[model samples]
Target: MTRTHVSLQQNFAGIVLTQGDPGYDDAREIFNAMIDRRPAVIAQCRTVEDVKAALAYGQREGLDIAVRSGGHSVAGASVIDGGLVVDLRLMNEVSVDTDARTATVAGGATWADVDRACQPHGLATVGGRVSSTGVAGLTLGGGSGWFERKFGLASDALISVDLVTADGREVTASAEENPDLFWALHGGGGNFGVATRFVFALQPLPVTAFALLLWLPETARTLLRTYRDMVDRGLPLDLGGGMAYLTGPPLPFVPDELQGRRLIGMIATYAGSEAEMRSAIAPLLALNPVASMIAELPYTEIQSALDDPPGFRNYWSAQHLAALSDEAIDVFIAQGEAMLVPSPSQHLILPWGGAVADHAENWPQPHRSAAWVVHPFGLWEDPADDDYVISWARNAVAGLQPYSTGAVYLNFIGNEGEDRIVSGFGRDNYDRLTRVKAEYDPANVFRLNHNIKPWTP
Candidate 1:
């Protein structure tokens, strides 16, 4: 072992994994199977002191540091080759306050951890559609989720965040403390510091409904139009979900003939009873779905139903639309038809107007003003299909450029370029976020993410 590695092992109060270590390979695995990186050290931290020591060690040795929570970064920013990774997975602890209607989640905790803890109390906060995503990563990147229309973005529900800064200082950001840092944390990504914990005000979730309705590709255009009309005619904020083009899973609810085939589908979540959901979505139901399933399940159960398993080659991109014009709908439908069949790709268009637009000015994600988000999520297994799948997602975004609002949701995309980063958070917000980066991480110690270079004025 190198002198620095030996020193870290001796001084660091965490499980320091080096090359050839027993759990090193497994510890390096992230949600994206495509990312193969070997960090010089993987510090599996179990306490805040361990995080501080790891940060100081990396800085002292000039090793690039990657802060990992659930390790769900599509770009694989959570792990770095020949560097140090502060793996916070061991710090996954959550405490829910039933009386205060709030949840305090450790940085490494996943949405599943948060939801399972809150479910028993019949309370929930906005979280990513898939439960495996990290609470800190998703929330800081302007979390978009199943109940965003009703609860606002996950960052919107954030009551406070505790973080360890680049210079080894522990701090907290909230409305009353470090307010500027708090504002930048919303949708700014992991550009400032290593978030250790987050506090969120939860909402009552007494009755929840989950539904998935499927139809053949031949019905794509028809169902899309009906779905668009349903959203336009004032769908309630309590109803959330989207339409997508995906390979039909072999679920019992899916027709035997349709399993493994490409299909157009709608997945819906309602913050109400199954009967109310049936009434609310009656218009789409009247169109005669080929295969479907609806259940009055617990909120936690439905939240995890769509969790994408790891070990798949993944590429994704998103475009925010000013409005879903019929012309844009045609472009979206045509792209869905051109997608790689029998793959796990999804050409999605989700409504974003209710609580999202309502609270747009509360944070820096200007794209929330958009009426819809077109996300083309590409997931396949073969490395040979990587180029094809990436091109498909890129072309999906290009096709709708004419209707795009010129802003994006960073979490839905991989590392496209700096221009796309600027486009994600408008140029102005990007400028402001840099100033915050300058304060907490002037040397840009945390540069693995959608990095914001420290601003000097």
Candidate 2:
């Protein structure tokens, strides 16, 4: 091993890996199979001190640095070629203060860790749609989840964040301390610093219900219209979910013939019992579903119900819409029809508003004001089909451009361009975030994410 590699291992409190070392290949594996990178060093951090040591060694050696938790970035921002990766998987932990109605989660912890801890206490905060998603990455990008319509984004539930800056200085951001940095953390992503821990305000959630209803692909247009009309008429804040066109999963409720067949589906989550949930979604229920699964299960069970298996080549994009016109609905259906069937892809229309819009002005994600979001999530196994899948996802968003709010949710998309990054946060909020970036990460040491460059005079 080189002297530089030895030095980093000496200083770090956790394991370090180089090429050919045991577990090096496994450590580099991430959610998106399309991303294949070989970093020079991988630091498996176990503590905040290890994070500092890893950052110092990477900077001292002039190596590009990437921070990884769940390694779920479809853009593969968490790994770099011939650089250093600060892997935080060993740091996963969650501490709950039930009396305070809060959860302090380690940066490396997945939403599963948070949900499992909070579920026992009948408490929870908003979290990622996929249980395997990292807490820091999702919250930093303005977290979206099933509970958002009721409790707002996961970032909105943050009480404070403990971070280690680029220069290895430790600091805390909250409403009472470093408030500017705290404000920027709402949706600024990983541009500012490496978050070590997050304290989130939790709400009591004694009961929860989930329902998955599916119909033939031919019913998409009618189903879409009925879904839109129901949202337009004002659904309860306690109701949350989305509509999708996807290959049906091999579940008990799904017919054998339809298991791998393309179908139109609707998923609903209610913060109350199954009876209340049935009442809330009576309109869509009246449409007659071919397959259905409705149950009052633990919140953790519902969080992982839709978890997609990893190692699939993945590509996704989204468009926020102020309104879903009938013409736009036709475009959505057309795009869904064109998707590669017998795959894990989904063309989805998720509802917003409710608590999402109620807290719109409080954060940088102005897209929260959008009434609907069209997300094309592409996941397939064959590399030969890459072009076809990617084109379908892009075209799905393009067709709805006329009704788009011109803003985006960064977490829902891969690296599109710098312009899309700026649009993720509005111009004014982006400007403000740049100033904050200038203060905490002026040298731009953490630029792997949807970057916010430091302000220049």
Candidate 3:
């Protein structure tokens, strides 16, 4: 029942929660524990009309507006202190359009919602590796997952978006309709408007494949060689996976001898028949894993394998590379040796070539030229060891600057600042994005994100 864009502040019809409201603080917070903001008013939008009223109200009242879906932006772009936050957390609705082979996802829905909805039908759309991640932020920012190697990404699979413009009018952007907006949203991050619902193409998800993991004992060289070959000839399109260098944890399952030692682990996914899956991963399995945990499980279970519990302690950082060169392997080993800790934190080099790399020029993504995504993530619950956690993250991220391609995945970025956002789009991609943002949001109403500056007139 939502109509096109029109200023409707005078007829605003929604809950405008002020600072004194009991739920105000909860409304402005995001998944990242580090971010803390106090929006002057948080609008709990139950419908598109509620969103319109909130936007129109913000514009007319001379206040900035921030739209929050999952509230998971690493840049913490979803909310602002003393501004207006249009919260769509209550709008999580999943509808499967089986005939169209598409799923209509509400803005507030997370990957968990989508995955749970589609898994029963043996169909899945591209989603983030983390199930709790919101569909809106991840999708708009270019969703990547274990399946990305075979299925492309969430952004490329976008079919349409129902959005509310600056003045509160609703519109739909799609490839055949608003092509420019479509391209921008594909990887440009949020700029056009508040997308309330997203339609995505879905594909069949396999019941299981061979998931493999072998620990590397200071074996960076051998691991890198195997990685290069794996990426060159991926396990299987059905078997989207990666092998990683790791520092062993003291989990009861890990032999006490290898615990707390530098080891390599292969986090693999074989999306095919068991026999084929086992054969596809045979090369890496042949590498002699200290301990192996490979099995034929359901797709939904594997997708949720690394699901971190809520209220988890998380610290993540990443770099982009055009190629994982031999010289780079030296750097990887040297840095891993220095930065590796006795804890569970793992350093990862996720292969980035294949369909992810075979893009035409000017695809609107700055990291397009990059060949792989390297993420070194840490997790711990001890508040007393905050220094140790921060130190580990900094050392690992700092040493890899030389081999990195400029820019990064917005999802993997930390509190590095506005500068990192500019870097995420690459110098050139940022320029074009700024222009696109200016075309639609001239006043910068959507400034509370990995912001694209309003274009200079």
Candidate 4:
């Protein structure tokens, strides 16, 4: 190895992998198989000191640095070509304080880690729908999950965050300390610095009921209208989940005839007993689903139940809507019909007006106020169908432009462009975030994410 590489390994209290290193290939593999970056160095950080050492080394060596936690960035921002990756996978740790109703999670910890750690105490905060998603990445992008309707986004529950700044400074952002940075982190993504730790306020969630109901694709139009009407009439905060059109998986619960067929499905999670969950979704249940699975599962079980398998070529985009009118429902159903069947793709319509809207003004994500989000999640195995899947997802969003709020949730999308990034946070909030970015990361060292550029005259 080169003297510089040896020097970095000596200074870092963690594993360092070069191109030919034993674990280099596995270490560089991210969730999305489409990304094939070959970083010059991968520093698998084990402590805060390691993160600092790696960041300093990258900056001094004039190599681009990408901060990686769970490595779930759809755009593959966590890895870069011929750059340095400060990978935090080894730092996955979780400590729950039962008395304080809080969880202090290491930066690399996934939703599964958090959920499993908090499950025994019957406590949880909003997390990403996929259990494998990075806690820091999702929370920074305004966390969306099953419990979001009840407890708000995961950022709303954050008590503090420990970060390593672009200049190799150790700092903590909280309400009483570095409050501006804390506010910017709410939905600004990883533009400012590398988050090392997060303190999240937890809530009591002793019981969680989950129900997945499915129907033939032909019933989607009627089902979409009914779902929209139910949301319009006001559903309880305890109820959380979305309706989607997906290819039925080859699970035992699904009949053989429907295993690969596109079908309409509703997934509901209630922070209560099964009976209560059934009552909460009675309106739709009355419509007579062809297949159903309902149970009082542990919160952890519910969190990981629908974990999306990794190594799939993924392309996703979303549009937030102020309202879901009948015409919009028609448009959504049409998009669903056009989805690539027999694939893991989902044309989702999720409600967003519960706790999400109530705290809209508190953070940078003004799109939280939108009543609905139409997310076209495209996951396929073959690289040959890349263009078709990407076009379908893009077209799905374009079809609903007339009904959209001109805002978006950044986490639901890949790297569209700077305009879409600005739209994630409103123009005003984007301006504020740029100032924060300037203060902490003036060099724009951490520019791999949906970046907020450092401000300039």
Candidate 5:
């Protein structure tokens, strides 16, 4: 290594890794196995100051910069080839104030970290479904979770975000400070800057009930229709979950005949007791699911119950719908049949309403007004199946376009295109976000995420 490289490392409080360094390759690895980027340097940032130093160094060196948090960007935006990555994983810390009912989470923290910390206090804000998802990436990009319909999307709970801007400035965006930027941060992805910390408004969630019921794929039609009917009839705000088509596992609840089979599953969570959940799930129970499990558990336990193991090649996409017509249900089920079995893929139809629709106008996320979200989470181990799996997700989204709202959740997709990105925020919000981008990042230094180009006067 050059003397300059050694000197640069000595000037920082965090660790710096160059190519061939002991943890370099592992540090560059993200959630998707399909991404194989090799950054020239990775600054393992520990503090806001460390983040600032890394940003300044990357800009001064004219290196492409990617900020790494939970490293869960499906597009692999957290890492760049032959560039610099400000790795924030080491900065993970969660501090909860029980009195104020709020949580201040470090940039690199995962949903698991926040949930665990807040669970003890009988408090939690909405977070990503997967426990390992980065708090900053999810919240800044518009987080949707199991309880989103009850409280709101993850971004909706955000009180403020501390960020390191393109110009190496430490700034905090909140309702009372830089309000325009704060609005843009909602459903804005990571376009504006590198978020270092986030403050979230917590809710009283001392108890929650969880359930998982499985049936043969043939029951998908009945299940989807029942779920649609329930939503139409005004399901309780406390209930939130999705119907998924996944590879069934060999759990005790599963019949020996159904284990390792492609099955239709309903995972429901209620913001109440198991008895309350039982009453809420009666209609579904009447459908006679082949296997089931239900219990009142800690919110943290439910957060990680469905965690997909790492090291799987992943491809995912979503379509927001204006309504779930009968035709749409059939099409959704048909696509589920195309899903790769003996794998960890999830063909999901998630209800979107209640708080999601009520608070849609308060943020930049355009898809919030939609009645439903169709997500195809594709995860498999074989590289040979990449094209097929990606195509399956793409086709699933395509089939639902007739009923689409034309807006999508950015977090649920990869690098689709500029058009999809614009659709995510809609034209008006996109214009506003661009103006904010122009003010904070005129040069577009943070363009690795779903980019919003600076507005030119």
Candidate 6:
């Protein structure tokens, strides 16, 4: 295990970047502006053998290791300070088997990449609304998206993943093989190892219709009420819906009349025939859109529509609630209308009862009790106004606590440490996950992400 004795250059067939290396800055950058950490080296790995070698080097030298796939981790967990980063962004390869309804994607692939390859054949796996998000991190965090109500979370559709463990071993975890590791990898953060590849079960890809977008400031109460009723009645398996408070941007998509304003947006998508898609959304279309951008676009374009935003500094803290109560609605609207920022920063609440709420066991994921996720998110440009955005979000969450289940999504969190991450899992689930962490990584080497610390020896 001598550091220099082993021929690392020969062992690793991928590129490595030390300090001052051309790719070091790009490798360290994450989506969250609040985080800035520099790692000693960045292993921009290509092959699985590269991942194995990087892990082995980190282990032998007692160096901290950070596993980065998309580099979009909100908590800045994908990069570390003075550590070794195994950057998987370069491993973008995919193969499809249409007959078996499955796709094996390289770990670094994005939602856009998956859709481009799969949508032509009218096949798809669970992908997020944001197109640029990595398939590995998002799916592993229990993905939610347009098709989530009909299909399941991305993790549930997983067949297997090729991972590099803490002990420098490459292994595959699937339902029928390595069952416990497979169970933990789904919705569990990167605890056991760095996932190098994913085998996902494909579902039918339907590009049916785009419903009207209704804009209303006075109808927040009615919209949430009606939305809840629709969910309770059990929506058609072909239908998917989400409602949010959106701040109008400068895009031409928003009419000049409504630019730079806040409006409640109710949007839906359906996978049936064109007529059925129209009928499924007839209830909302009746409201008469103040300004609408609904059209018949392919599912891939629809999913990636919001992929690029005029980049701005953002701060976010999120909580998943048992229900979206009237009081919660009021708090959201009040905070939303109080927007003092320049860029698109607004609160988003996505419901979760359809396929996600039916979980039967106490896995590491504690989002089971939550029916909706309230994201107090905002963005601004002036460094001085950063305080305003964070404070505004903090106060809103403080008031809405009574309705919340005290659970938070790991991916949406800002760069806080171990205690905050443990809180996100709640007391019981956090303890359970901690035990699992102890069983997998007792030395606490994998402590960068929304961490669950292994119990002290």
lDDT of 4 at 273: 95
lDDT of 2 by residue, 1-457 (tens): 5777999888568999999999999999899999999999999999999999999999999999999988999999999999999998899999999889989999899999999999999999999889999998999999999989999999999999999998999999999999999999999998988899999999999899999999998998899999899889998999989999989899998999999999999988989999999999998889999999999989999899889878899999999999989999999999999989889999889999988999889989989999999999999999999999999999998889999999999999998999999899999999999999999999999998899999999
- Candidate 2 residues lying further than 4 Å off, grouped into runs, are none
Model 1 C-alpha lDDT per residue in residues 1-457, reported as the tens digit of each score: 6676777777556799989989999999998999999999999988898899999999998899999998889999999999999999888899999999999999999999999999999999999888999998999999999999988999999899999998989999999999999999999999888999999999999899999998888987788888888888999899999999988898998878899998989899999999999998898898888899999999889989988788998888999999888799899989998888898788898998988998787788899999999999888899999899899999999989999999999999999999999888888888998999999999999999988899998
Candidate 5 ranges beyond 4 A from true positions: none
Q: Which candidate do you rate higher for lDDT, 2 or 6?
A: 2
- Clashing pairs for model 1 are none
Across 1-457, the per-residue lDDT of candidate 3 in tens digits comes to 1122223323555455777667766677677665678877788787888887788777877777778887767556788877788888888899997777789999888888888888778888778877778899888877778877777777877889988889676778887976767777877666778989999998877466646466665565787777677767654566676656566655556788877777777787766677777787776667777777767776667767776654435677888887777877777666566544565566777776555655525356667567777777776556676677677767766767777887687767667777787877777777887887887788777866667787896
- lDDT of candidate 6 vs native? 0.75
- The pairs that clash in candidate 5 are none
TM-score of each model, in listed order: 0.99, 0.99, 0.88, 0.99, 0.99, 0.91
Clashes per candidate (backbone, < 3 Å): 0, 0, 6, 0, 0, 0
- Report the C-alpha lDDT of model 5 over 229-345, residue by residue, as the tens digit: 988998888988989999988788887878778999998999999999989878999999889999999999999988887799999999999999999999999999999998989
Candidate 6 C-alpha RMSD relative to the actual structure: 2.8
| Candidate 6 local lDDT, 1-457, one digit each (tens) | 2235245556676878776768667667776666788887788888988888888887776778998887777667788887788888899888889999889899889888898889888888778877888898888877777777678678878999888778777788888877777877767778778888899999887565555375867877777677666666766767765776776656667787677777877666677666777676566667666776666778887777666553466777777788777778788778766656345676777677666665525355676558777777677767788788888877767767888886666767666566667666667766766676787677777778776677664
- What's model 3's overall lDDT? 0.73
Please list the C-alpha lDDT of all candidates, in the order they appear: 0.91, 0.93, 0.73, 0.91, 0.91, 0.75
Q: Looking at model 3, how many pairs of residues clash?
A: 6
In model 6, which runs have C-alpha deviations exceeding 4 angstroms? 1-8, 211-216, 360-362, 415-420, 423-428
Q: Which stretches of candidate 3 lie over 4 Å from their true place?
A: 1-29, 210-212, 233-235, 245-263, 338-344, 360-362, 382-388, 415-419
